[model samples]
Target: MTAELDTPILDNHLHLDPDHGRGIDAVEDFARAGGTHLLVVNKPSWMLEDVGDDEAVFRAVFETTIDAVERASEVLPGRAWPVLGVHPALISKLTGRGYTPPEARDIMQAGLDVAAEYVADGPALALKSGRPHYDVGDPIWEASNDVMKHAFELGAETGSAVQLHTESGQDFTEVAEWAEERGLPAKRVVKHYSEGRLDGPTASVLADRDELEIAAEEAEPFLMETDFIDDPDRPGAVLGPKTVPRRVEWMREEGYDDAIRTAHVETPAAVYGIDLEATL
Candidate 1:
């Protein structure tokens, strides 16, 4: 199953938000449209909305992520995978900004508990926070390390994959270095789109690293995204499964076979340790 024309390719990184019309059904439709596999992210917006504001909402968001993954596992079996994410900003939202204390510790511990449960489930747990604060380089960042390591440990225990998101290009390299320095057991580190870098530069950065994974989208091969926003007024409002194929062709034209090859979908099955061979 090489990534030839009409071959079933896995979309290694796809956002699955029900609010944005990207979820199991959208994934299935994508698969039917030629995508053989999809890694659906399970970070619900409610995870942010409920924090500090409403404990019930926060719990409900976490529950929704778990339930969504469970349902996806049952539905796709080997096709859909889920990547659970914990945003660092959530802590401030839950505990209030710069207001640390014994109670803050309690709140963080509670958050960690929820994080640990998701990690234990074997889905690819993604740390969606940025550098220094969340970078594995600083000692203060050790907290982030602890969170990632805990997730990695759980992945090691269950033979699942752990994915890390580096929002900055420099931090992306820092993450790869941190993984090497600490001997973290993560198999894949995903470099989310560096805010404003061009595709060529981003590809160059990713190409330099062997341990990191890059998620390529159809239009933006450097930035992996799948959810089609519902705003008809937007210029790219008609994006869909066709986007993947176009990106693949664009990369081919640019002689980016390596980048194209590294691209794979993040599916619930992959997160849960299903051993389906990579089809592309």
Candidate 2:
């Protein structure tokens, strides 16, 4: 249904778990649904078999994402880029293992440094960082913010975009402030799993009809994503990989061609500094 439209359908955040899930077949599913591009982000370090104490543990996670992106790109119409970093939830894991809040934050920052190296060395296009979505005490929360700030610094140094996964319901103006203060443009910071609000950093609105309508009504360019975890056990726990392209097909049928172009073409290119049209 979506193939008739030449517009790109880029999923802003996706995870491909080759070891325990559909792996590249998931990418094929997205392709069949008319998805053109993806940002295959790294899963959390704890998802790996070994959640080691050292910051180097994240390297394996990033490498797995890189491999997944390489495989998915083969099936995508546009491209699949890697987005690597230590998941903000890692602080909880570290603290559970007897590390203090500040220590965990330092470890997360170091892990992001590794991710930044991958971006600079050409395996990844962006960095992912955010505080835990659930509530926590003041110290842990503050520490998580520091870790996110370090990610912003890395983004500034490496010239890569940053994707965030914070708790929902409020404007992310504070996050935007942090990004700008670290020398990374607020526009380059994407709020993944967003609800189509423009009162924050760049939005990667979830591919829901109501949310897409809100974003389209705003007439502001924003990216779309499914946040598909690709977990076989929890099938479609977030949204399915096909969600974005299917939503795009719906948008086109509804005569939202301008929104389609803005989201799938212009906004992604602007945020990631990639030429989606040229890549195609």
Candidate 3:
């Protein structure tokens, strides 16, 4: 049973790409399970998914995400939003048969341009960009880092908070510094799947009850996530859509209502620059 909290916890991050995965009723399941809002990122990691090799075509996925989330929101009003951009892990996939560094970089920049426009002009609440995966060796890391820096510039220019997805345990201070150097405030960042502080707030995925407690103690006003892949084969891969509410129940059992209220409610509201508090 989903915990009946007066204030529904908002999942800071999750991957519910329209075509990559997730059912039509994904938003409803999250809502019924006590999730009030989610930042669904479209991990457009490959061309095999019918995206083709064109940069414009790849960037169109962000627009499609807006449409998809809108459709979901019809079933659960204002419950779903998008966080779209180039994920570094998807670089190789985006490259396709004619993989070239310069070509891929230009294509990614195009995607970031689209992301910035949506973030400022469309319903996209934020942007997500990161190295394709952890330390893909120095050569790969340097190139990806340069591409990600452009993303940071977009985040800074558009005043959109960037949700980072680098490898776990990597010092994100440099990531934050990159944004800050580009004129974006470091605080306007959310480190996804973080274990400790880097320079901004962090969010957790699949942490157990005890782990969650330790995380909260380590960082005040952080966030929680399920990273719910919504894939049938790996159903509830990290945690299900209902994960946050279940964790909230655990916190309550341990008498940690304050932590729940902050991470699940107030903090998200402030970070996303929208109202997500106590809609219950």
lDDT of candidates 1 onward, in order: 0.43, 0.88, 0.70
TM-score of 1: 0.58
Candidate 3 TM-score to native: 0.88
lDDT by residue for model 2 over 168-270, one digit each (tens)? 9648898899999999999999998899776668999999999999899888869999999988889986999878889988888888889998998899878
lDDT by residue for model 3 over 107-145, one digit each (tens)?
677777778888999789888877765445565567677
Candidate number with greatest TM-score:
2
List runs of model 1 lying over 4 Å from the truth.
Answer: 1-7, 19-25, 44-49, 52-59, 66-78, 95-112, 119-160, 171-174, 180-183, 194-242, 252-259, 265-280
TM-score of 2: 0.97
Order the numbered candidates by lDDT, best leading. 2, 3, 1
Model 3 segments more than 4 A misplaced: 18-20, 45-48, 51-53, 94-96, 196-201, 204-207, 278-280
Instruction: State residue 147's C-alpha deviation in candidate 3, in Å.
Output: 1.6
Query: How accurate locally is residue 81 in candidate 1, as Cα lDDT from 0 to 100?
Result: 51
Ranking by TM-score: 2, 3, 1
